[model samples]
Target chain A: MTDMLPTGATIGILGGGQLGRMLSVAASRLGFKTHIFEPGANPPAGQVADRVTTAGYDDIAALEAFADSVDVITYEFENIPTTALDALEAHKPIRPGREALRVSQDRLTEKDFLSGLGLKVAPYANVESPDDMASAVAQIGAPSILKTRRFGYDGKGQARLKSGADADAALVDMQGAPAVLEGFVTFTHEVSVIAARGIGGDVACFDPGQNVHKDGILDTTTVPANLTASQRMDAVLLAANILNALDYVGVMGVELFVTQQGLIVNEIAPRVHNSGHWTQQGCTIDQFEQHIRAVAGWPLGDGSRYADVVMENLIGDDMDRVPEITREGNASLHLYGKADTKPGRKMGHVNRITPRQN
Target chain B: MTDMLPTGATIGILGGGQLGRMLSVAASRLGFKTHIFEPGANPPAGQVADRVTTAGYDDIAALEAFADSVDVITYEFENIPTTALDALEAHKPIRPGREALRVSQDRLTEKDFLSGLGLKVAPYANVESPDDMASAVAQIGAPSILKTRRFGYDGKGQARLKSGADADAALVDMQGAPAVLEGFVTFTHEVSVIAARGIGGDVACFDPGQNVHKDGILDTTTVPANLTASQRMDAVLLAANILNALDYVGVMGVELFVTQQGLIVNEIAPRVHNSGHWTQQGCTIDQFEQHIRAVAGWPLGDGSRYADVVMENLIGDDMDRVPEITREGNASLHLYGKADTKPGRKMGHVNRITPRQN
Candidate 1:
């Protein structure tokens, strides 16, 4: 049942954003055609995809047709509607499986699963009602965060709690959605492990990259993140354990907080993450190709880092600096081909190769 | 008039083979869309391009429409029909210009142009008639080659002359077409420089790569070709002189023969050469991207190579070994997404990274 997809097979991707765009290019590299299902017209991925279905996920007929045309189904984003997945999964296999999506869709479930596996996570509790919120505050205390359990990204759908008295205001930020209250874990910095699990249960992890965020968005990711040998080993091992627990079958991004006591798991994304973009220049085989290989059931590639690289996202107004960036030596520019430049929009990224420190 | 193409502009490619396919991917990396014009249905480039026109080159109306749809025109192969170029050039800028095409279209003109620039070339004479063939034989002697002046590649339209008595047989191979009789020269090995010229007249050349051909098709290209520093500088300078003389804007492949005398110019290709494919693994900027940058009027990327690489072409039954190749570590596989693999057809190529020797 784990037969690999043959060359010339069409892989259906659910979202047609920049991640999907890079994945489409990587799929073409391996002699596979890609069919993109994007709701927006002229999606960034559609320009490179072999075919695109410009229909909403609610259009079950379109989803079924998209599934029927491809050998397997994979996604760029994890917030896919349940009905769309149900329809598509009926026709073809969706890699990373429903179990991964089920475990990662809710913050409460993901935290519980990681903790159950003997991994350290930020202290948290459910905030469903007024009494529950008070009990959560009493248990976890103030200086925490109230985050909706699902569909939150890039600092959206989140509110910070200054003290126990601020619980009501923070709950208001949830806007009636199920929420999780997380106590702040003191950490020096953040790092992420880009890991992949093949169909035959083989796991591989790229070296951790240190991430720095600005205004709740990823600004830059630097490889060879300052870490002791033991910390790096622990990061890879915990990421592997999570993938094994979920029986995952594609690349997963495990964000970890580096602390004096130990590394704490912050979050796990089912699809490729922004922090892994550096692999495009640092490794022979990048994260997008790694995910495609796992989903296609092919043998994994060598993910070893050969150079020091810094990947910086070009968001919004950064497009104006393209002409200057194009002249910078050793900088690899990758533009998203988006039509408009809206503030806070991820325009593209540039990977700058730097000399390795011995 | 020398202005850079803004992001979101379309680049129209004239041929839709593997080279065009890779070019389209590179163009997309720089935020430009690609439209491929090819007579064949479902060309390999079309699978990744934003648009594809499936009309013959003789269709002037289609050519005009394609030109109108793009900001500039470039190509993968050099054998484009003149009438098509006439129509497309009327609507948009055709990069590399007509002078380049005129000089490279015929073997006689190419040889004359190179020798005119004081570059070393094989001794040759025109053979348009029986009397001319006799004089060419007398002047060049036996153990030579008689090749048609136009549309010859991969050892086609060529015949060997073992002796003066075999001149008639070699002429017969040309089928009464205009031909050239060339005297052979002894060389140690063959090397090629993949060089590019920007709109601003800036020239950059990748390191020479040693080439080995099998059955007249390029089999392998190894970087860091064995050459003294003086020989390397001579190769690059000679290539730059040719581009400068022609005012060429795009990447060109300059094939050279290494002999006891010096490097001899074997031939020049107006498009990216197979020998330059190793740059995909060895350098920060590859030949395809360098070509795109030149055509788009942008500054050329850093052409400096940082790693040792060997590129091997996969022809015919080589597709059968893809599974084994995929499992090999450090081997970067680039399949052309070709649907059929016929004998002698280029299905794809693989670039293997090796340790750099001091």
Candidate 2:
């Protein structure tokens, strides 16, 4: 068994966005200081982290220095460049490991991996060229979505196809980048299972939360998601299967589509997910803290929900209501220290908690 | 009403210890940055704060720079040098105000203020010399405790007087500092109410938590304390009275001794108290976050308890049990990033939570 990190160990975080900021706070709660490495100056995580290295991922010297300064490394985002990981892995251990990232970094690979584990996912076909797009359309049919294979997030880098006649436009939207045509599933609603795997391969999963997205961005996630007991069990089991298969040792957010047939895998985030923010108010230990514990080689905490919570994201102009939100008796607000409030950008979130029904 | 601080405003905190560390995290959660000022090198708060000013309180230049950089100022420890506060207050507003500090900084003043407000407090007499000690003993009688008037905490600068025979020795223990003779109250148990006052004079108090002390240090604080509904209401009312008395605009920890007759105010802390740490898992917003909200002139969050929590302190060697503690399914451990753990030094705490019964 791997030795657990003692208090006062420094954790190297690869990104400095809101996820990294929250992760840094959680790391500090566990007596771990974080050193955030981000290309952007004055990133959110840097505001609370012990230190920050402002350099691009391709800067091998910076990566080596960051890796050498910390005991263990973890990342807030999975789109980290392969060359950067190659440099970092040589010097330090990265929890969740490289395989988890390699699988989730690409759309096609994530779908293939989930399907290989006997989990149902949207039918998808790789589209490398215009001809491939026609073939994909023929196979996957119309009313599918064409998404880039890599480096897409928050509804970015995706194009919708209404019919076969729209295939050429969707193909053009891909800008000749490698893409995947995913046939849309007629699902009732979306839910996500936030699970963690300890270094010793122990898996723990929080209750799945029903998610609602607006304009391709997550708007709210409510606990006690409309899931039957059997569906809940399947959600957790599938998430655990993915974690164990990858030998993952960190928190993973598995977005699932609750359909008439069964739970279909939508996607997976290898770090703390937005849908899991409700856990901060609803569970004993939140997803960020659980991730910190898992990466630090501590035992995974019980992720059972103790309260019903609805977590709503404060996006851009939604931040204008903060003063009023602050006055709400049941609302717990969490704001990221970002200066700019661009449209669709997440500024903060609030979790409204209520007593759990037995 | 004071205008609320904008999201990006900086909060200046004095005494960069564990309290400041937790407060800094809370400030970050509200989109505010913290600048911690401490005389010691590598203070715990510095690990999670946006800026750290390592300079003595007497350093006027450093104080000026810090005050100029922050919108509001607050202190973690009440023993801050008067000259320092005078310097900082000239530049920025200090929430919970200087009056709250002046009253709580000295035990005698605190006792006097509570009694003047028609709150029950243990009989106390000021002691400046051996003659005064003898007079105090004559008045307050035996089984009294001699505590220094200033710069004392965690049972320090205190001597127990069993009878008249021990008066001289107890006076000697004072080391010539001004003291207070507090007649020991026969209390069934101790409870503390964590309360907050917003800039708008809105007050909110968390349910009192029963505290257990070991060797004059807080060991555990359990919510749903052994109190009748009447006692609970009295605790909250008295706490609110104290806050209004000082026109306080921040969190206060009011420690009370439950006597057969009524609740006696033992003392009050101007900042978030250790006994209230249970709220981190029991409430929608923890005491630290409430303190930040009050100081920032934002609306106070609901302080009602939603869970039954027992918070246990990890002091000194108790940190060794952290590995075992982390493994406990219901435990949520919070470790201070203190490099050295001397005997009696608080290392961290854990809050074990369960659902609240209706």
Candidate 3:
């Protein structure tokens, strides 16, 4: 790839939340300035970024100016407006590419794409209308999840169908948006591999982190996840396959379900994942820096875990524990400079670290 | 201590250099915003900091405005002007306080302070005139070094006397500036103890790092320094003693010489030192973050080293090796966002890490 971006290049980032804030810090560490394109006023990313353009993604003039100013464009979150990408792509390269975003933006497409690769994914069917929902319920059966195919995150835009009797209510919950009915996988645990693909096609994956969710949001992620040696290898190989298939460049968070049959693809986020936050304390190169390196066309860093870490998200009221957490010497606190602490908001995270066992 | 300054409190940093840049990044990590006060345009720290005020320290009105804007004041460099501190002291508390600056700003005062603390500093004498220089040489002997008492850094404003020859020329080199003559310690290796003092008088010290100087400029700092366990303890104890004596409220880098007699104090930096940069990759809590925590009146982090790290400085032309360094998976690159690369300028550093031995 064209002699890794020389020092002093500007990285244009979409979405100016905590992820963008951390990414901007990582970019600055690598001698790159960041220009945050955040529609919101006084974004957290703006506090650390070199520049911030406070304009909506639909503002073509602002988008063009941002694209023109940066050497490369990347996003902290998926579901970027298509028009924004169109405007940005004409000006600079967007790492992770449009294909990754296109496939992962919708639940149905992501499942179909994973299934197409001969990867095991939860049994799923697309649902558009009431008849389609009935048909999906018949095929996927009860105890399935009905979710909007796009722009859904956390527990939002989703409903659980305990039985075929709840199909009508589940479908209504999708609010007429194109939806997917996914049969729940009988899994032992949920784990995520934070992997990166360089411009040269080299791939590296951090050790999978065993995750727990509270209120459908990631609560904690612990490294040295309970896995056989073979399972660990399978996780890395599968993540690499997905990155390669999409011709991806930059970091990706691949969620997987460990079932008795095999590993099932849960989902993929085309950016740094909350589950990977432990890497900041456990590894030499963090996920944010790894993403920046890939987007900058530099060689991928070793994702080897040097320490065992447990990362707990400080969501909303969880921030009240800051005083106590701050006094915990082993805990490395990372607070997102968000002013408000409304319920369910990710205010920060703390990574408690310990030496790894041989 | 003052409830830890609360999140989002602004930290006013004097001297917008690489140290300030890293400190600002650390402050941001802790949810604290940083305002950089710099006389130069587009300083490296300003690129990452939330705010930048471009004005000389002597500007009383600007200083007052900056002091009013920040909740607390701290500095990156020791040679802060007296007038600036006088203007700021009324509006905000400066951590590490005036005593650190008062002693460290002059080579003579620093030596006297260290010696008064029962620390073994090099044999030294103050030089204000030719008579003093002549007396110093008569008492301390030949092959000693003469350095200006103030404003000397990175081998600048220094002269060496060999066999008492060129004494007149060495004195002339001072240009009437107050100077100090020091007898060299017959040491085996140079090491630095990076120590921090919290607001509650709690002290934590990282293991000493073996440092190598290239032409009086630090080139590399490797952890697990060549020292006996007893010597290591002494280093930490002496460092803590210095902090306690000053009633220090921030990180200090204590340079020492391992001599046949014992460890001798070389000097101490009142702020984060370049030698401690390796902690960014080697420890869970790095020196920069430690400094931030101390200055912010938060509990000091555990200064535990989890990995053995060799940090190599990327000085000016050394940046040409960045591409090669980037390819090294074990290397964690930290580049200061410097636009220009002049000879003798520190552009960046790379921390090469390996798991520590049991």
Candidate 4:
């Protein structure tokens, strides 16, 4: 029986980005406290949480103290060091467990897991070394992508292959690190389905969102995704299946590509996602609240929307146009407490809610 | 004209109850830093804010330093001394300003302002001394309430008089302090309209909430109030008229009694009102956020709800049922980080949103 946590329990979170910040807000709204563990000088989540452990990920004593302080452990980002998780697991439960991380840390392993679940995936091969790279590329063919798999986010750690000469150069550029060669798909659009699973195995999903990315980062996510009814059903079923198979006890995002042929898996994020930010304004219970409920051992709220929504990320300099956007439409502006607006940084987002009726 | 008070500006908040706590959350959400100013050692609002200024209200040095550090000053409760407001106003602006607080702090003065606007109010009189008590009671009625005209909340600082014999005793019991005697209303129901006036004189009101009170404190507020379209129209008009009269900038909650005669004014809070907590889940922008926007010189957001909502306060030991309440329905729960929950104290509230088919 899952009886370790109660309503007033404190949940430990790693990483202090907007996801963690939103997670802390959601946790408080549900009678729970969140203690954020972040390495930086100041994490955005620290501004609104009960407590914060400001120590590097490798600081064992800090990690030990953090583990001693919280009831259970969860993370906002998946790139937390394996050793850190191993040490924390000695004391508290880490939901979506370390096994899920092992399966997802490497691109080759992730694709294998998706194929094992009988899900559609891009043709992929493991690039063990530069010597074996040419043969692997020949099998996967040109116009493929070479990805490091582990610790890659926002289009980093991945190289695109366009021709035979480019394959060897990409493999050599990767420097013998274990990589995966994924055949490129001619997809019409990209979408993500965010779902959650409670400890009791109860599952709920938000409507899928059609996402547009620029410079390899999320730009906009529109709900009521441009998908056929059957295709939307397939996305939810796929997300739930992934959560169940991993025994996940929180929210997870499943990103996929919609092509003329069918749905192809792109990636899996085992936490609250950016694409679901529209829920804050459009739905009764949002993804962050749903994630908190699942992990806190409470029943999930109804995740139904009363309006159609469009959420646009205010990346870096885009934040300067908040006044203009506010004047243009009845949009809700959310700016993160970031100190410097450097290039490629996520500054904030704006949510525009429209009546369902045309 | 509104420049330099950007996202990272710190706001100094006086009082640290649930109102201050919610204001701190909303302030942090907009990338603004909040520094809570309260005399107590531990206040719930401190848990989420950036800093806490623990000093006596009259400590002019601490107050000066606090005002110097923050861009502006605001408070949760309206009973703050005029001297403190004077000292702070010398350094920074006070939103909704001191005039609004002075009027709302004195019940007799508040009634004058409302009556000046031709709004309906219970017949009242000022009793400055025991010599005038009998005349004041006779002018109002036998079944009238004798209340101190200043600094009263949650059934405190007042006594009720049912007959002529008891009227003298009630007047003596109040120690010959300044008081108002009001004829009791046999109202059909009670409701409140929470409205806001931005710095640019923009006015917006949430749907009026039908309220229930226990021990003269708000117990629950149900939206999609049991009011006819005409009544709703009157409520909005009354609130807007008050805003224009006061030249107010920030949220205001007006308590009203729906009597057989007509709508009668009960009381008015010049800041974010407790009865409006439902706006957090029911609307795209909550009253707290709207107030922050008005004070910060940002454009107001849409204060419209897409669904009907019921918000119930969790007072004192009622917080013990938080786990059960959170699991029973699609309720969004909010708990203040108070260490002790004394009797009749508001520890938090829960909002249940139920979409209406109109």
- Taking the tens digit of each residue's C-alpha lDDT, what string does model 2 give over B6-92? 898999999899999999999999999999999999999999999999999999999999999999998888888889999999999
Compared with the true structure, what per-residue lDDT tens digits does model 1 show for residues A91-125?
Answer: 99999899899889999999999999999999999
- Index of the highest-DockQ prediction: 3
Q: Which stretches of candidate 4 lie over 4 Å from their true place?
A: A1-4, B1-4, B172-176
TM-score of candidate 2 versus the correct structure, residues matched by position: 0.98
lDDT by residue for model 2 (A1-39), tens: 248998899999999999999999999999999999999
Q: Of the true contacts between chains A and B, what fraction does model 2 have?
A: 0.87
Q: What is candidate 4's TM-score for chain B alone?
A: 0.97
Q: Please tell me how candidate 2 rates in CAPRI terms.
A: medium
The DockQ values of the predictions, listed in order, are: 0.71, 0.78, 0.80, 0.55
Instruction: Give the whole-model CA lDDT for all candidates, comma-separated.
Output: 0.93, 0.93, 0.93, 0.85
Tell me how many residue pairs clash in candidate 2: 0
Candidate 1 CAPRI grade:
medium
* Better-scoring candidate (TM-score), 2 or 4: 2
DockQ of candidate 1 relative to the true structure: 0.71
Clashes of each: 0, 0, 0, 0
- Candidate 2, superposed: residue stretches over 4 Å from native: none
**lDDT score, candidate 3:** 0.93
Q: List the candidate 1 regions with Cα displacement exceeding 4 Å.
A: none
**Model no. 2, DockQ:** 0.78
Q: What are the RMSD figures for all models against the true structure?
A: 1.3, 1.2, 1.1, 2.0
User: What is the interface root-mean-square deviation of candidate 2?
Assistant: 1.4
